[model samples]
Target: MKTLPSQLTPFVRSDAVGALLAETLGHPDAEFTLSALGRLTGVSGPVVHREVTRLVDAAVLQDRMEGRNRLVRANPEHPLYAPMREIIAATYGPVPVLRAAFDGVDGAEHVYIYGSWAARRGGEAGPFPNDVDVLVVGDVPRRTLSAIAGEASDQLAVPVNITRASREDWDAAEPPPFLRTVRSRPFVDVMTGAVHGG
Candidate 1:
C-alpha cells in the first residue's frame, strides 16, 4: 500500500506522516502500538516507526513503554494539536468516519469510495476533491443511504454521495457500466482499507 498524497499534508515530509497523524489524532483517546498503526494506515512497519518517532520527538505524539511494546497516543497538550487534528479530520477522516456511520446498517454488505477523493488518496495528482462518492453494494434503501451520506457530509465537511447496487448487479458476468468504470479506477474498500484498481 502507498501513502496518502503530499497535498494532504503540506508541511509533512511524507504522506505516511499525515496518515499516522490521522490514526492518532483522529482518535485521540485511543492508544496504539506501532505495528497496529501501520496495519490501520496501510503503512509499513519501518515507516510507521520512523514517522511515529519523529512525531514523538517533536511532541506531536506521546509514547510510553508498555512492557516490550511501545504505546503511542496523540499529545493533546501540544500547541498545534487542535489545528492539526482538525486538518486531518477534514482530509483523512472519511475512512473511519464513514465506516462508523455504516456500521451494522442492514443489507450494506460492501462499501467503497471512488472518484476524485479516492484517486487523491491513492496518490494521483489532482485538484482537491470537493465531494466524496460512495458505492454501496447490497439491498440498502435509498433513504437510509441518503441519511447516512448527509450525516457523513456534515462530519467530514464535504458532500457525500452514495450510490447503491444490488449484489446481482455488482457481481454480474457483465457488470453495469458504472461498476465497470469504478473497477477500472482507484477505489477503496471502506472496511478493509484496501486500494483496488489504479
Candidate 2:
C-alpha cells in the first residue's frame, strides 16, 4: 500500500494508521472486524493489526473478541475522540460523506471525484486541496445535484463543485476535451474506492 503523506494526516504515525482511524472513527457507532478494515483501507492484515493494537493500547479504540473475529470501534470515552473525529472528518471525511450523499441517486450512472482532492488521495505529493471537484455522468438534474453538493459542502467544511454530464456525453464516440482531461487524470469512484489514472 502506498504511504499517505504526513501532511495528509498529521500526527498519525503512518498512512495506514490514518486510514484505519478514518474507517473506525469516521463511523463511531459502527464496529468493524480487522479484516474488514484492512479491505476498506487497502492496508494489509498485519499492518492493520499492528495499528489497531497501538490504538487499542492508547485507548483510542476499543476491541473485543467475538469467537474468532475481533471487532473494533472508536472509544467514545477517549478524551481525544471529539478532536480526533473532527480532524479525521476534515481530512478524510469527503469519501464517506460524498459516497453517502450521491451513491445511488436516481438516473445517476457514475459519480467521480476529480481534481486536486482525488490526486492527493491517490498518493500524489502536493499542498492541501481547498475544494473537491465532482463529475456526475448520468441523467440527474443539475438542481438536485447542486443541492446535494451544497449539503455535502456543509458537512465537509469545504466547497463541493459539481459538473454534470449526460451518459451520452460521457460515452461519446468522440470524447470532449474536458472528458479527455478527466479520463487522463486521477479520480475516485464515490461508490467504490477505485482510483483511475495517476
Candidate 3:
C-alpha cells in the first residue's frame, strides 16, 4: 500500500504531529494548549508536547506561556507557513474529517477514499485535487451514506462523491472490473479495518 507523507518521514511520522499540524497550521484561527491538543488528536500529552516542541523549534508553530498553561498556534510569519498549511491540508486533513463524519453512521464495514485526492496524497504528482471520491463497503443504506457524504463535504470544504458496494462484492475473489480498478489505485482507510488494496 502507498503510504502518506507523514508515514514516510521521521519529521512528520507521529499521529500527534500530523494532527497538530493539520488542526493548528491548516486552520490558523485556532489555538490549543497541550492537553487540549492531546485530547483532539487522541495522542498522549507527552507525545503532543514533543511534537509541539519540534514544531516550535522549526518555526512552524509558536508557543506562548499563558500563566501556568502554554498555548500553541501556527506561526503565520514563517517562510514555510503557507506551503506547510497546504501540505497538511492535502495530506492529513481528509481522513480524520471523513472518519468523524462516518462515526455515527451504522452498518459501514469499511470506508476508503480513492481517486484523485488519494492519488495525490500517495505521492502521485498532479494538479490540486478538487473532489474527494469515497468507496463505502458494507450494507449501509444509500440515503444514510449520501447524508453522511453531504455532511462531510460541507465539513471538509470539498465535494464528496460516494460509491457503495456490498461486503460480498468487495470481498469477492475477483471483484467486478470497476471495483478491481478502484482497488488497484492508492486509497486511505478512513475507518479502522484494512482496506483491501490499501
Estimate every model's Cα lDDT from 0 to 1. Answer: 0.86, 0.83, 0.74
- Candidate 1 or 2, higher TM-score? 1
Clashing pairs in 1: none
Give the per-residue lDDT of model 3 (tens digit) for 44-143.
6777787799889988899999899999999999997887777776656777677777886778888898887766545566776788999999878989
Order of models, best lDDT first: 1, 2, 3
For candidate 3, report its TM-score: 0.63
Tell me which of candidates 1 and 3 scores higher on TM-score. 1
lDDT of 1: 0.86
Q: Which residue pairs does candidate 2 place in steric collision?
A: none
Residue 176 in candidate 1 has what lDDT?
A: 86
1-198, model 2: which lDDT tens digit per residue?
545554567577776676778778889999999988876666788888888999999999999999999999999999889999998888777777887787568977888889998887777778988999999988888889989999999999999999998888788878899988888888877665456776
TM-score of each: 0.89, 0.84, 0.63
lDDT of residue 196 for candidate 1 = 80
The model with the greatest TM-score is 1
